[model samples]
Structure formats: C-alpha cells, structure tokens
Target: MKKFIPLSILLATLGATNAQADFQGTPTTNAPSWVTSWDVTVPCPVYVSENQADNIFFEGGFDYQDARKTVDGALGYRHLMSDNKVMLGANVLYSHEFPRNHQRISYGAEIRTSVFEINSNYYHRLTDWKLTGVDQNEEKARGGYDVELALAVPYVPSAHFRVKHFCWNGIASNIPTNPIDDLKGNTFSVSGSVYDGLSVEVGYIDYTSGNADYSKAGGERFLKVSYNFDIFGTHVNKATKPRFSNTPYEFERMDDRRFEKIRFEQKVISANKTDRDA
Candidate 1:
C-alpha cells in the first residue's frame, strides 16, 4: 500500500522552507509564472491595496482553449507597511480544469512595493489520475514552488515587466511514460493597465526536465485582459472636491452661523446673572 502524507504536515513543511526570509509580496496571488505575463495578471484575480489597511478582495475568471478549459477564483488579504510603500499579504486559491477534470489548491505569501513585487507559492494537487498505458494510479499528492519578480517601467506608470523561475519534483502523473521526474522552468512577460480598472498582458514560458536521455524544452505563450474594482461598492473619487457633499463655501457658512448663535446665547446668560446680583 502507498503511504499518504497528511496535508497539514505538507503545508508546514512548505512554510518552513522560507521562514527566515524577509517578507516579500508576490506579483499576483497563487499564480504560476508560466501561466501569467505580469506580476499582477488577470483571470487569477485578487487585488490587494498598498495604501489601504486590512484590504480583502475576491476575484474569479474563465479561460478557454480548443480542448481545455479552466475556471479559478481567489480570496486574499493585505496589510500596508508602516511607510505605505510596501504591502504584505497572503492568498488562498482554487482552480479546476475541464476535460481532464483536475483541480489545484495553492497557498502563498507576497510582498509588493511601488517599484517591484516578489511572490512565492506552494501548489498542491487535490486529485490524482492515471494516464493511458500506466499500469497503476499515480500519486495523488504532487506539488511545487515558484518565485517570481516584477519590475516597473520608469517611463510608463502603468507598465510592468516580470520574470519567474520554478521547480516541480514529482512523478509525472498526467503524461504516460514521461521520463521526467523533476522539471524546472522560467517565464517572462509584460503587463500594462489600459484604463482605470482594465489591464492587458502577454507572456512566454520555457522549461526543461531532468531526464538526460529524453530532455525536452518547449515554449508557451499567453495573452489576457483583466479588470479590478471594489466589490463592496466603495468607489474612489478622483475629483478634488467631495463628489456627493455640499460645497466647501456652504459648509463654512453653516459653521459660521452656528458659532454666531452660540455667542448670542452666552451674552444673554451673562446679563441675567448681573441683574440678579444687582
């Protein structure tokens, strides 16, 4: 019988791997580098603010292809650094792939600043399957880690470029007789905001396996668009004045009138006291 490891133990082990490192934010929550072009890619969809405290966000998206389809969602939280220049946070993500019927769960931490972001994640396969010609069912417990970096363009406020490297060390459960036991890959991409809440991105990925006799290298590409906004109806006003309140001059006049009434009442009370004494 194949032994199964407890999920708690797995999580603990992953967490300890980077316990001593200083906190750094991820480009995006729980996203693998090969799958996204920017640190904050769309479709993986959670937004954490760098200036807001206790920010919580939820995002979901769908991706389609000729024979594969994917749907994913994320919930995340962020706390601003004391200086307001950095944000630290964590996220929990879930995704399901159709046709093949596989699912993934990821947990990770990230650090984000005005100029760049750093993110790390640990991914777990929740279900296991066997490919054709494989005699036995493969391991249900497989996962990996990825570290990503994103840099902002000095001239373009909305544009950011990113790179990532990752490693996966497990049996190849999805491909039959694939001589790969461990794989390492790198990804590169660029992303930019087109409008207030809309963004566009493009990325490329290449990877190689440890198998010396059958080493393989291939490239993957993607183009995507994503939008970010407050789900609770809290809209940010860009105007200098209050968008839904009275004008500043009107407010000042109201304050002045209240102060005048207070002064008149004080004078009347003082005259009454003096008359009683006399």
Candidate 2:
C-alpha cells in the first residue's frame, strides 16, 4: 500500500496538467502540430496481503508517452507493520524526454495507515535548458520537491471514494530563473474493483500555482481511467492460515487412526511370542 503513493502522485500530476489545458482554453493559431497526448503504464506485479495480514512487497512499472515520445520506469518496496495498521516504503523514478533532450530523476519516502497516506519526493533536473531565454550558453536547469496526501473511504464492497492533495516548490539556479512557483492542488477520485485482479478509476483535479512573472492563479479539470493487473492473484490468497488446537484431547481425537495401527501391531507381536513358547 505504501509503494502506491509515488505512482499515484505522478499520475495525478500528469492528469492535472491535462485539466489545466482544458480550463485555459485551446489555442487556435499557436497550437502545436502535435496536440493530443497519450500515456500507457504497465505494473509488472502488485502483491497485496490477504485478510489484512502483515507482509512485504516489491513492485515496478514502465510508462510511455506519445506527445514527447518518452519512456520512463519506477520501482518501489513496502513493508506492512506487525499490527497490520501501517506501512512504510520508498521509491525511485527516472524519465527521458526526447523532445527536450532532457531527463529527470526522483526518489521519495511514503507512510500509510488504514485510510490515509503521505508521500514526499525530490526531483533533479538533468539538462542544460534555459527557461527565460534561448541562449544555450546561459542555460540552467531547475529542480523541485512535492508532497502528496491521499485518503480512501469504502462506499461498497467493490467501490471506494478517494481524495488527494499535492503541493510543490521549485528552485532555480543562478542563471535562468525558475518560471514556476509554489503549486498546491487537490483531486477527487472514484475507484472500483471490476474483477478479482482488476479495477477502474476516474478523477478530477483543481490547483493553484504562484508564477514568478504574473503571480497569477489558475484551475484545471482532468479525467483519468486506469486498469490494474495483479500477477499474484488477489488479496484473499495472501491471508494467514488458521491454526489448529494443540490440547491433549484434541490431539488424541486427531490421531485416532495412528493409535489403532499401533494397537494392532502390538497384538501381532504378542501372538508371535505365544507361538514361539508353544
């Protein structure tokens, strides 16, 4: 459960960006030649404990984007607490954007309880790109950190209501100043289990960001639908097996067949001894 935060935050941010585009209105003349964007993600495995049992898990996934022709990957590990009420984990992510000829690397930690989760991560820019000007020699990269909080509530056996908040702060280098300022956003989502190892989700996002030049605020509406594959079956399979009683009477009842076999063997030995005596 803790390992899910990083991936969720990434997807939420991506969805928020799309929502912003819709709210800001489409550009008629300045629209890019390639306007539509699409993304696909695959989770190799998602191990969930059965019956709320305590356990550890590792998960990884790959992602592709059509707009930038970019590919990315993420990996994480999580450990459930002995009480089965909490979880802790960490994750690392990397992405390559071919259009901008740049890359991004990030890592973070997460903590989760029965109904809530908190995740914080730091991102590093690995490119020499100027945000303010086109001078290649004066280019400088930017980095930032983001924190996310998520909540879940069960509406039915297979349905849940989810909400999340995201906050981010950007830092700039000495040369080109950072165009983005502090950003804060919230998202509301509904998710439901479609099958044993599959589920579907839809969400909406709204946010405000402080800009360096204009110091303005804006909001966006976005939607996301996702399908999940679980290779290790479902949560029911991971439950702890029940333990049997060890009392003497119960043991005797359980071993009745063995006791009968022992008695028959003793009788056969006694009969053999009587024949020898005769």
Candidate 3:
C-alpha cells in the first residue's frame, strides 16, 4: 500500500491545474520557467489504430528546484496525427513546496510536428503562506501565461531554438482587472538533448514587472540541465519524442525556461508599498 498512497496523492492532483516551484516575491534569475508549470488529465479509455492512437497517462515526479524543493504531479492525454509525424496534447499540473508551503497549478496545450511545435500555459497560484509562520499570504501574481514556439533543426533531431513570451495577467484579487501589456517578458533559448533522459538549455531572458519599468528593459543569461526517468525514450531522443519518455509517469516536468511570472510579484508589492507610504 506504500505505493498506493503516493499514487492516490498523485491522482488527486489530476483534478488540479498546472504547477510551479516556490517564491517569496523574488525571482531566481537563473532558474528556467518550468519552475512555474504543471498539468492534470482525467483518465479515459485508450484506443490504438494504424493511423491514430490516443492514451490517458498518469505521471508523478520530484524536483529539487533552485527556488524551493517541491513535489508535483499530473495526468495528460496525447493523440498522434499525420502518420505519427505530428501530435497534439493537453495537461494540468499541481505542485506543493515543502519549505514555504506554497502551492501552484497550471494548464496548457501543444501541437508538435516533425519540424516544429507550439505550446502555451495558463498558471494560477494556489497557496502563498507558511503553515508554520505568520500568514503572510500577500501573493498577487496569481494568474499569468506563457506561449512558446520551438523549431527543430533536423540535422541534430534534438537541437532547437525556442521563442517564448510571458505576460503577467495583472494581480489576482477580489477586485477584477486586466493585464497591463507593459508587464510582460520574453526568452530566447537554444536547447539540445543527449542520450538517457538528459537535456540542456542556454538562453537570454528579458522582462518588465510592476516595480520595474519596461523602458528600463533588462536581460539575463539562463542555463539548466534536466534529467528524467523514462520507461521509454531512454535510448532515443526525448527532445524529439518527449511523450514516449514523459507520459505514463506521475509528474509534469518543470521546464527550465518557464518562470518569468516571478517578476510580476514585484509589480504587485511595489504598488502596495506606495499605498502604505502615502
């Protein structure tokens, strides 16, 4: 039953949204974006045919993230298209941080072809306080989004350059509002993978938040190394066929370039500080 307990917890998160690592209103300038992502899928019957196949997969995994250590889980679905040269999928993620007791959820979808793919995610913060300390639940950057386009260079199979845009959907509060386009960010990165569930990424990231003006535009260098335990894609290119390696597991990966919304917290805090001082 030891295994059942963990499996149950993982399944429970399926009703959840996507996931992310923890933050105390600060940006870990170096960590990639997956730091803020996850997806969940409800189980459904599977069908396989010569031209098409679809499956419901359950997965769970761990992350010793740079910002905070966290546990994440998810369920997802995928379908092959165009003779398996193209694919479409969607997922929801749920994550909980061990340190600050932060919780996060997200949802996203993607379409991948032999040559390129596009994916997008919507993120929501679940919890923002320390269970053992003061209830400083002043979390504001609750809802945000990111969309990415990755182009594969056939020569290397795993080599690709991605363009991603992150937009802070203002702050989440009882008061309704709209996203301020000025509070947005972007990343340009090159990624490649090696054998045995490993990959690497290096990129330039730039963004603007509340306290930070878009005009004063800034950029930073980002790098990451990721590894996974794959029942499949262990010998093949996980980058080219990520589903084979990632599906049927319990956790949605924390993509290294997916964390720009961290900047929006500063925007929210800056506004609050101004009101207090005034």
- Shift of residue 14 alpha carbon in model 1, Å: 34
Across residues 1-278, which tens digit of lDDT does each residue of candidate 3 receive? 11112323533433242222122233334444343322211222233344335644544555554444556665566676555555677777776655555667778787765457688877776654233333432333345778899876434445567889886554433323422232466767776655435666656555544323432424444455555544432222333333222222222222211110111111111111111112
What is the per-residue lDDT of model 2 for residues 170-198, given as tens digits with 9 covering 90 to 100?
Answer: 43333354333444556565654444334
What lDDT does each candidate get? Answer: 0.45, 0.40, 0.46
Q: Return the TM-score for each candidate structure.
A: 0.57, 0.52, 0.61
lDDT of 2: 0.40
User: Distance (Å) between predicted and true CA of 122, model 1?
Assistant: 0.6
TM-score of structure candidate 1: 0.57
Worst 10 residues of 1 by lDDT: 261-270
lDDT agreement of model 3 with the native: 0.46
Off by over 4 Å in 3: 1-52, 128-141, 172-182, 213-217, 232-278
Model 1 C-alpha lDDT per residue in residues 127-234, reported as the tens digit of each score? 655231234323232367788887765544345677888765545323465423555667576766666556665655455544432232244455555554334333
Pairs of residues clashing in candidate 2: none
